[model samples]
Target: MPIEQGSSGNNNVGIGNSNPNAMLTVGGGAPLFLNQGASSTTPFLAVLNSAYPTDARYGWAFYDNSTNGNLDIFRRNGTSQGIQFMSFNRNTGDVAIGESSPLFLNHGSSNSTPFLAVLNSVNPTDAKYGWAFYDNSTNGNLDIFRRNGTSQGIKLMSFNRNTGDVAIGESTPLYLNHGASNSTPFLAVLNSVNPTDAKYGWAFYDNPINGNLDIFRRNGTSQGIQLMSFDRNSGDVSIGTSNSNGNKLAVRGTIGCEEIVVKSASTWNWPDYVFSKDYKLKSLQEVKEYVEENHHLPEIPSAQEIEKKGFMLAEMNMNLLKKIEELTLYMIDQEKKTEQLKSIILKQNEIILNQSKRLEKLENKL
Candidate 1:
């Protein structure tokens, strides 16, 4: 609660500029605190100025020396001799809030050393507990930081250099280039899963005929490859030229599991899962559940009895043919729509031509 201002031979009771002779000015105006120690130094303000804990055990202070540059903020620990938090480079221009170093800079064990280094940008040291984003102005990129178990993390997606892209690993990483969206693109993606374990995840970039996107993994290395391609005319599945390279190859042999069937273009947004909305069984569990819940159970059949109960091979073949017919019908419907649109356009063109001719005859008669 008590404040002191020192000037030369006398000390002022309340806030005011220190007299030219005072060694220190504790309160506001001009040199907030002018220290006239034989080595007379401009006074600095300590926000938590009390001898013991002020409001709480932690305390902070701010100093303003306009003659040098601008106002500055500083914080201190009860036992420490220097300010633990402050604004201003002791070696550079005067410390000013919103002037030079506007935010609180915590001085670690080293004197005047900044705990966090921000270059040409507004930086949040820590956000959402451990998330931090650095908006670098000089290079024009955003650097996002997240505290992992023993390290800092970042998103390594592609970005635009002209607009500013972020590097995945380092805080001060350079924003190099743009991505598919004509912005900064990422060169790589780092996985969080264990590196050695086959079950752990992996990531890589696939830059085929079109653009680049990261491919992630869960089980096998052979399956990690991604094909960045699409059929332009039919909008069917087609891998890009980059994907055509044997490098993007997936094991073509009969596999243990069924290959994922992409039903529609919009399905890319969701993780690939077995079956679509009309969920038939995706796994054995689903199959059992459906049989138990939907069908009336007769007594458990013996091996010989089961053979008689099961569908005949001919019946299975017919069901398979029916599915093929359904798919064929769907394709034919799409083709029909295409033909219909073309016919409508042609008819409109003929009508326009006939109308033009009629108008020409009327003009001649007039």
Candidate 2:
């Protein structure tokens, strides 16, 4: 090594002349290795400005070998202000861009705007793409916005942490009025495409007509075909239809099943009125006359009426039970009449036997 001593007590080592201000300088460096002590905790390079002697820190880039060999770069704001801007954690494989205490892969930290913004170019002409996470001021929710260009962007999604509701797409989501029960319900996807073309998709809507949470399948543009529905108030489930016409469940296609078991309390009012004291027991003649005149039983709907208004199963069952109870009463009345006639014949037979005995006695005396 060739050495040159300067007037300012500076030492220059190697082939060329050194700058006068530098304390120690190396000339003609193919590669210069400034190796600190072999301690894993110490930094490999520390560039400090000697002008600020009291606040001695400046900037440093180091490889930490103690843990998982992480590379950390730090910058100084002022004489005493040192801030770490970038870190690569080898253990977790996470790179902190503008943050020192990073929790995620690309974390950002600042006092003004703490977010990560990826830019294509510093100039406005190039396309910029980035995503920002922030708190929404209006509703006090967590919002994530995605930017396409520099100026124009849209809010990608938001989450209300308090209510556990998430919203996607445009800021103002579609308001599906689910009455007063559910306040903050989330909608997964709402796609509005061309109306004329047949687009196959499904949607859950609060139907105003039937007052149900209806699941509808969109086949074309002419509204949506109701696939299923649930009565939020009554807890009734309707399949293949909304059951707007008084059916608990309705299916458009034939059902194939191994077994279907129905367990329910019947709502039909049984015909116990026949056993009541106020029940009017009509004569058989009167019942026959009424049936002949009307061509149907009294208080029962005729065939024409059934065809016109359709049949109510519960009402039809109750009517049939009433007829059965009336028939039972008629049978009991006939049984009582037959018992009376048999008693009269027994008395007639006893009288005839006594008259024969008297005739036999008169003949013996003669």
Model 2, C-alpha of 86: deviation from truth (Å): 4.6
What lDDT tens digits, residue by residue, belong to model 1 across residues 1-366?
A: 445443333654444432323334434332333332321122243344442222222345444435444344434454443342434646443222332223323333121122333222222232212333334344444434443322333433223346443344442232233342312123323232122223323333333445445344434442354433333333333342333332333232334666655343442332222224453323445546766775622222345654675543344444455445444555666799899999999999999999999999999999
Using lDDT as the measure, the top candidate is 2
Best by TM-score: 2
> Which digits, one per residue and each the tens of the lDDT, describe model 2 over residues 112-180?
122334333222123345655555555766666565764426666666667555656563343222222
Each model's lDDT:
0.39, 0.54
What stretches of model 2 exceed 4 Å from their correct place?
1-202, 206-213, 217-225, 229-271, 311-317, 344-366
List TM-score per model, in order. Answer: 0.31, 0.40
Q: How well does candidate 1 score on lDDT at residue 315?
A: 40
Runs of candidate 1 exceeding 4 Å displacement: 1-34, 38-43, 46-83, 93-165, 170-187, 190-235, 238-252, 258-316, 319-366
